[model samples]
Target: MVHTHAGFAVAGRPTRTRRSAVALAVALLAVAALLVLSGCSSKPDVVPSADAASVDVAATVTVKDMTFTPATVTVKPGQAVTWIFDDGVVEHDVVAADGSFVSELMTQGSYTHVFTEAGTVNYSCSPHPRMVGVVVVE
Candidate 1:
């Protein structure tokens, strides 16, 4: 009588053996490598900064009908406030009541003033006393 080894086989093909296990291991390693590579290429959402530039604060007021557009303004200390003269016919000046701040006569031009103290400063146009504005520094 003749006998054969008992393993996986088909009627017309050879049986699978240790070679199939090696193929599966290689495929799994390839997939894991792809995942690791993709994760390394991603970037963070926000960037870090150590030294940022200072900000410039400015404002404008018109002299058409002798009135300030925004009668009052609030800002941080050390911030600059600019008053622009939009009307061509009239001249204006920005002068603080307590002599805290002042600007030269602006004839269709812009005037800038920097607030260094934390307080409310009442200012008005020298030529037109009716035009009043306030700067609140915090």
Candidate 2:
């Protein structure tokens, strides 16, 4: 027994209620983790067209040295464009000029965009406006 400031006897051990609460909390955490893990996928799902023998070209851009590589890229109207972030230190993002698309802040990974219309799409990094790129959907 431990004496409290008010001179009351306090058991210095876990009570039955406390033990049950701890066990319940742990069980809830485990269930939440299982739910999250169940939704994890191993790879990106890519659907291939059955009519076309060749797959549509997917454009890729590289972000390095605070600049968008190639700066300008042309792709077919149904093609997908992916941006790969090569810089690991500074953060960057891609936002279209006409509010078409926007990417989350990226450090070192990739983001993709598909051009469905035949037009020129200009994009720039929101944090660094000087770094710009263009996508010409033809």
Candidate 3:
């Protein structure tokens, strides 16, 4: 059957502008869906440094497998605490929540911080914030 607009004979379909609008709407919806999905997806995996596996454990906190081993440590005031990145396949860093100390991007070896103030100090790897640890100085 033929379609009509304003009593005029036309094809049995919508106008070009109407079709284009539908197509544009579909395309926009698809783009929006992709954007939402991309935000929900997992983040990129962390890669270990070249010398990560061979480091000694001189640190009180150890970062491995995207986790902080021995997540909490207790010590007396003025005692020194250290953090070592022992994960062979992930890079990490340490930062105190209270601006007390910060470590360089550590993939191996240790970073030492002496706690002089008596309080609880919480820290996490900057690259992997989920990897959290704490130190209690009494």
CA lDDT, candidate 1, residue 118: 95
Report lDDT per candidate: 0.67, 0.77, 0.72
Report the C-alpha lDDT of model 2 over 1-138, residue by residue, as the tens digit.
Answer: 444443333666656566788999999999999998886633223222222224364677899999999899999988877788888789987888887777777798777766789999999887788999999998
TM-scores of all candidate predictions against the true structure: 0.56, 0.59, 0.59
Superposed by TM-score, candidate 1 places the C-alpha of residue 77 at a distance from the truth, in angstroms, of: 0.4
**Clash pairs (backbone) in predicted model 3:** 48-89
Error of 2 at 117 (Å): 0.3
Task: Identify the runs in model 2 with alpha carbons over 4 angstroms from their true place.
Answer: 1-57
Residue-wise C-alpha lDDT for candidate 3, range 52-134, written one tens digit per residue: 23433233777888888789988777567767678885778777888677777767877777677789989877767788899
Q: What's the true lDDT of residue 4 in model 2?
A: 44
C-alpha displacement of 90 in model 1, angstroms?
A: 0.6
Please, what are the lDDT tens digits per residue for candidate 1 over residues 21-132? 7788999999999997875532222212111124356544555567877888888887767676776777777777877656666577666666788999998877677889
lDDT of residue 61 for candidate 3: 70
